[model samples]
Target: MKLAVIGLGMASKPHLAALKLLADQIEVVGLYSRSESRRAAMAAETGWPAFDSLQAVANSDAQVVIVITPPNARAELVQTLGAAGKAILMEKPVERDLARAKALVETCEGFGVPLGIVLQHRYRAGAEALADLMASGRAGKVLMARVSLPWWRDQGYYDTPGRGTLDMDGGGVLITQAIHVLDLMLSLAGPVAEVMALTGKTPLHQMETEDFAAAGLRFENGAVGSVVATTAAYPGGAETLELECTHVALKLEAGALTLHWRNGQTETVGEVTGTGGGGDPMDFPCDWHRDLITDFAARVQAGQAPRVSGRDALRVHRLIDAIERSARTRAIAQVEAEA
Candidate 1:
């Protein structure tokens, strides 16, 4: 499958490396970036054609287009490719604003195009195994879930122009940093029914977005959850994500899977650390990206619906949107009907 990955950000490097593993199956035909120097550098490194325009990239031999641009430009880019009749794999948050997110979904629907959001956390081994446990009734019942993260980002991180801006990066902690785990939270429990959140800028960071965030979420399955994510935590080592259910507790330090459950009626569950990547949430199954791309390509080949279609991405975006709205109004917001 020929693919084009638009945007040369931090996440793009892994995708490029992953494609190297499946060199026989996938070929990156095009690369797109705004930074002339970085774009030239990426092209020189990959030995791929560099295009000054996204439309040219869309029209190239790349049957699959991966939009890794900022959330603000994602919708327009997706819509553009959809117009060109291309299958798309986009980075998270769908769009910078809810209206644009909804518009992208609607446009894709009208065009009958295939879209996949890069919520790669859903592709993690730990998340998949735990989801299986919960679904198989081995976890008894989900009584509660807690998604917490105290990740660190240096002051230099937000120094970039669009680093923490609402118009470009979307929301700060939850939308940008914690969204993968949060999406995994929703994927584990169920779609969020409502969310009441508080977000603000506590530290004098280099940007205007919030540095601290906390939220209370209610899952539609009657499971209650709490979320706390911040960049203000000092001496940041590893961010933590713990999900507790009726009789099971699954914890991931960074992204590795760990499970603790009641052995007997009152017995304590044993301790063991799971394999797979634990630091970068983006590093999951080696073939996860390939699986995602192949799935989209297969759908495009068969003229069928994609597993992570644009509508699916819109649902994730809705949760992100509701989180931001919930923060502003300091009230719970509902997830809208899927289009």
Candidate 2:
């Protein structure tokens, strides 16, 4: 399979690196970026042809296009690709807004193109194993879940123009950093039925969106959940998801998983790594991205939906939308029912 890449920003490096790992399955045939300097730099570095426009990318022989642009700037490019019948694999959170995300999904569906979201955490070894355990009833029913994303971003990080803004990066902690954990929570505990949340800008950073967020969740499966996310935690900390099930308690800290069963047995699965916590957001391993990209290539070739399809990712967005609504109203907000 031949592929093209758009947006040469922070996420571009990781995606490109992962694509390189999958060179046996897919080849990057073209590249695009609004910034001529970035395109030139990438071309000079990789010797790949950089297209001048989205139309050029769509017109290329590349069968799939990887979109690593900001959440707010994806609709137009994705619509163009979908209309051209090119398969698309986009970065996480789909879009800055739920409506536009939905519209993008519809456009892809209408064009009969497969759309995948870059929720690569779902492909992590620990997460996949935990999800399988939950599905197999080996862990019994999940009673509750706790997610903590104690990430830190200095004032200078948000001071960058378009950073942490609703127009560009979308919402703060919840939508940006915590969406991965939130998506994993949904995968393990099922859909959130309702949410009540509160958000505010922390003293550590000056930004239009919240630097800290806490939410109460009621999952459709009767499992309760709590989410605490912040970029204000000094020096930051590991992002963890603790699921208390009837038979066992599972804690996924960073990329590793630990299981504590009712029989007083404890076992750890997978490896622990930095995962960009307390560091630059883009600083993390590309293994999971490689897995997801590999899956995307296979799905594209098979004419099937990718593991993390657009519709699969919209659930996370809907939960975030509900959390935002709850924060605004200071009341419980029902999650939007999916069609």
Candidate 3:
């Protein structure tokens, strides 16, 4: 399979690395970025050709296209690819708004094309192991869970004019960072049925969106959860995404999954890292992108849906949308409408 990557940002780097990792089965032939310098930089990193326009990029020999574009432009780009008859792997928060997400989903489904969203956390070894444990009933009833992402983003990070603006980024830390943890939370604790949330913005940052978001959640499986995500923390430690169940507490700390169980079992665990990016950020204990791309390629080759399907992405998207509404109304919001 040949792949093409659109957008050259911090996130796209991992995708490029993953493509290299999957070289045995796939090759990334070309890259597309609006920024000429970014295209040059990526071309230097990976010896792939870079193009300036989406049309030229789409017309390349790649059978698969991975879009890591901004939220606002994703739907249109996906639609264009859909019309062009190209398979796509898109980056998440499918859109900054729910309506656009729905339209994009409809467009893909209408075209009967294979469409996927990059919720790569689900592909991590620790996540897979814990998910197996949950399915095996080792986690018991899963009474409650909490997800906290208190990472720091200096004002300079959002100093750019468009940073953190609702129209661009969609929302703040909850939408950007916590959404990954939220997907994991949903997987572990089951789907959230309802939520009541409060969002806040401090003068510590000069951005149009909220810097903090707190939500109270009731899961469909009778589990309760609380989420507090913020980009306002100072002197941040590791970018932490932690979860606790009735019988197990799991966290990804310093790039390892730390599991603490009721019977006094506490240890860091993960699966064998496969042949993938071999250094620094790539060599980190967990290479989410490599595993995800490999798995997706395998599934696509076998004519099966990806483990993380587009519909699953839609569910998580709905939950995020509900959280936003609950925060805006300062009232409980149901994740699903009444049957």
Candidate 4:
């Protein structure tokens, strides 16, 4: 498929790498961003041609357009892409909040274009195994789940204007960093029905949004779970999710999965891989991104549904919204009904 990328920033590194690896499946014909300097850097660095203007990108022959801009700057860009009849693969959180996210999704739908989101954590080998088991009903009903994102980000990381602020990147920990794992968790365990949360900022980072969030989740399937996501941990550790099912118990940490069966036998699948949960946000490999892009390109050609479509991504966004609501009201908050 012919493809192009917009908003060539720090977040575009893995994507650029992924596009290179996926050269056979996707031809990255052009790159664009508001800053000519950034476009120059990307063109010089990756040898991908730079589009001089948004109109140039819209007028191009690229079938798939990857929009990797910050959360605060997406609506108008997506609108333009939609009008240009370009299928979009956007970076996560869709927008600053759920309402904006929904409108963005509608904009793409109005163009009758497929919109995919880059929640690549769901493409990990371990996550795939667990997801297959869940769909197969071999693991039985998940009775309980435990999720933790003990991530760290030095104050300097958030020192950039609009880094941790509500106005720019949305929320601090949950929306920006933890959203990957949160999306992975929801994809594995299904939708959350309700959440009671306590969220606030620790002194470690002077930010506008919460750096720490702890919540109790009640899944629509009658499964229960706990979530502790934060960036306050020093030198962050690997994020983890544990699911205790009727047939067996599974633990997925980093990129590996361990199954503890009823017969006292245990087996592990996948090798441990860097999660980028620590200091360096781009520390992880680009393999997962490659896999996700591979699927997306195939689906785009086949005229099929995306593995992580924009509307489907709303599951995690709704869960995050409920968490913040409960954090504020100190009461149980229900996940919003999906359309």
The candidate scoring highest on TM-score is 4
Whichever of 1 and 2 has more TM-score, that candidate is: 2
Which portions of model 3 miss their true places by more than 4 Å?
A: 239-255, 271-286, 337-339
| Cα-lDDT of candidate 1 | 0.72
lDDT for each residue of candidate 4 in 121-208, tens digit (9 for 90 to 100) = 8888999998988899888888999999999989888998789888888898999988888898888888999999999999999889
Please state the error at residue 244 of candidate 2 in Å.
0.6
Error of 3 at 230 (Å): 0.6
lDDT, candidate 4, at 194: 98
- Candidate 2 on 1-339: residue-level lDDT in tens? 999999998778888888778878788898899999999999888778899998999889899999999887887897789888899999987888789789888889999999999887887788988988988999998899999999988888888889899999888888888999999989888899999999999778889999989999999988899999999998888899999999999999888999999999998888887677685877788999998888898889998878889999999999999999999999999999999
Rank ordering of all candidates by TM-score, starting from the highest? 4, 2, 3, 1
What range of 10 consecutive residues in model 1 has the weakest lDDT sum? Answer: 267-276
lDDT value, residue 323 of candidate 2:
95
Stretches > 4 Å off in candidate 2:
none
Residue 1 shift from truth in candidate 3, angstroms: 1.3
TM-scores of the candidates in the order shown? 0.87, 0.98, 0.89, 0.98
Residue 175's lDDT in candidate 4 = 93
The C-alpha stretches of model 1 lying farther than 4 A from their native spots are 264-291, 302-304, 337-339
TM-score of candidate 2 to 2 decimals: 0.98
What residue pairs are clashing in model 4? none
